[model samples]
Target: MLKIVVLVSGGGTNLQAVIDGVKDGTISNTEIAGVISNNKNAYALERAKENGIPELCVSPKDYDSRELFNEKFLEAVDSFEPDLIVLAGFLVVIPAAMIEKYRNRMINIHPSLIPSFCGKGYYGLKVHEAALSRGVKVVGATVHFVDEGTDTGPIILQKAVEVEAGDTPKILQRRVMEQAEWKILPRAIDLIANGKVTVRDNRTIIAE
Candidate 1:
């Protein structure tokens, strides 16, 4: 079985989706070895504990520098010896060192289609607000390999959500979260697990 490690920093709705997917055989060949978070109070940690998954909080605030924090975080995650790392809603900017070590082994789900409205300072509800403000007809989510750059990794999958005329950031976000985010994330993970997806020349290729 593929050993999986999930990282989260907020409510664990997406994390729940992954757990359910694995339980139901939608995502095969994986066992969630651990769940890590930067916030001790993050609700995702509670979910992990409830499910009997090992949980850890390696807060960046406890460290003197980003590099030090990254080292500690890497140590915590490496303890699991995970085959894959899933970022459910983790908010921190992971250092390049960890990115290099994991490379295609790490994956992240972003709120926007990416390369468009993604990077430092663009996260959570802020991404949705930016899309809505831009009057984008289509807004959606992306699951991609985690590279050194922000959301610039090879895209594994993308699902679009239509923006309604009267939609607020909250409303649009909820719609996309349910219709797009929840569905595509597990599928992306499954693809990686099953060897149906590959990153070649920084592009994701889905095999038949």
Candidate 2:
């Protein structure tokens, strides 16, 4: 089985999608080794528990310094011996050492089509806000390999959603999540777990 550890910081809608995918065999030959959250009260933890998957909270607030938090956080994730790390809605800035260790084995679901409303300061509803401010007609989601730089990773999959009139940031966010994020994130995990994905020259090549 491909053991995966999921990281989240919120309600875990994206995390739930993975769980559903695994249960339905959409993501074959994979098991969730654990779910780790930075927020102690994150609903994602409860989701993991209800599903009988191991869950943990490693918050930076509990540590004296960022370095200490980073070290302990990495240690906690390493304990699960995960083959793949999935950042579903994880908000914490990943430590460089952890990123280096996991490299292409780690992937994240960003709220927008990268290189547009992506990179630093673009997450959650902020991405939608930017797209609306720019008056773009199409907005979407992206799944990519995690790298040292912020959201500057090899793109795995992207799905675009139409931007409707009178759409607020929150409205657009929901649409993107429903129409794109929830779908592609699990698909990307399935692709990686089934050995249908490859990273070369900072891009992903999907196998036939």
lDDT of 1 by residue, 1-208 (tens): 8888999999988999998899999988888999999998999999888889899899999999888998999999899999899999998888778788898999999998878789888898999889987888998999999988888899999999899888998998899999999999999888888889888999988985
Error of 2 at 100 (Å): 0.7
Steric overlap count per candidate: 0, 0
Stretches of candidate 2 off by over 4 Å are none
Clashes of 2: 0
lDDT of 1: 0.90
* Deviation (Å) of 3 in candidate 2: 0.5
lDDT tens string, model 2, 92-174? 99999999999899999998888898988888888888999999999899999999898899999999999998999999999
User: TM-score for every candidate vs. truth?
Assistant: 0.97, 0.98
